[model samples]
Target: MKMKKVQEILEAHIWAGEEDLEGEVYAACGCDLMSDVLAFAKEKVLLLTGLVNPQVIRTAEMLDIRAIVFVRGKEPSKEMIEMANHKGMIILSTQEPLYMACGKLYAAGLMCESED
Candidate 1:
């Protein structure tokens, strides 16, 4: 899915990277544990989490994640946003719960790395 499609599917609001919304996302990973993000996510995948911390952005940076989705209406801190901006990562916030958001995207053909 492309970033624009992801935003539409999750009903997410883009907090950054308006110009990069056309970027493509082949897979997704959902986790709140930053350590897990470091340990597992693959390249060019979108991260879905409820955690709103700078570490989340750092995790994305380390793994070269293209975008992040904050589920359950959560939003990141200003520092986190700045961190992601510096890394050129797209940030999105959605009112949908984590499971529902993941399900909706998965049903729309965005698979997890394990499924790939």
Candidate 2:
């Protein structure tokens, strides 16, 4: 799915990297464990995480994740947003829980690495 459509589907607020929202996201991975993200996430995927910190941004950069959806209204720190912006990673926040957000996006045709 396109990042814009994912934002709409999740009723997300774009917190950073707004200019890059038009890009495509072939898959998604929802997890709070940074190790799991680093181990499994593929390129151009959207990361849905609740762990709000600079390390989340760092993980996304390492995986070449195209976007991040902060679940259950979790917000990123200033440094995290700045890092995401610099890496061209679109950041979004939603009130939905991580599982719900992931399900909604999956139904909308976004899958995880395993599903693909």
Candidate 3:
């Protein structure tokens, strides 16, 4: 799924890296635990999370996640935004609950790529 498409799917607000919303996302991982995201996310993934912290961005950087969708209307911290911006990750916010957000993305064809 393209970042632009994901934004549209989630009806999200882009807070940064709006220029890169056209970037493609081949996989998605929904999680609040940064540790689990780091442990399991594959390449070219979009992270759907409610954990609003700087570490979220840092974890994304390490895992090469290109986008982050904050579920349940969560707003990331300023430090998180700055970190994500510096790393060129698209940051978005949506009012949908986590399960609904994940379901929408999944139903729209964004899936978790198998890691082997």
lDDT per residue (tens digit) for residues 1-116 in model 3: 88999999899999889999888988888899888897888889889999988888888888788799999999988888888888888999999998899889889998875533
Per-residue lDDT value at 6 in model 3 = 91
| Model 2 quality (TM-score) | 0.96
Model 1 CA deviation exceeding 4 Å by range: none
Looking at candidate 2, what is the lDDT of residue 15? 93
Q: Which of the two, 1 or 3, has more lDDT?
A: 1
Angstrom error of the Cα, residue 96, model 2: value is 0.2
Write model 1 residue lDDT over 35-74, tens digit each, in one string: 8878888988999999998888877887889799999999
Collision count for each candidate, in order: 0, 0, 0
Predictions in order: lDDT:
0.89, 0.88, 0.88
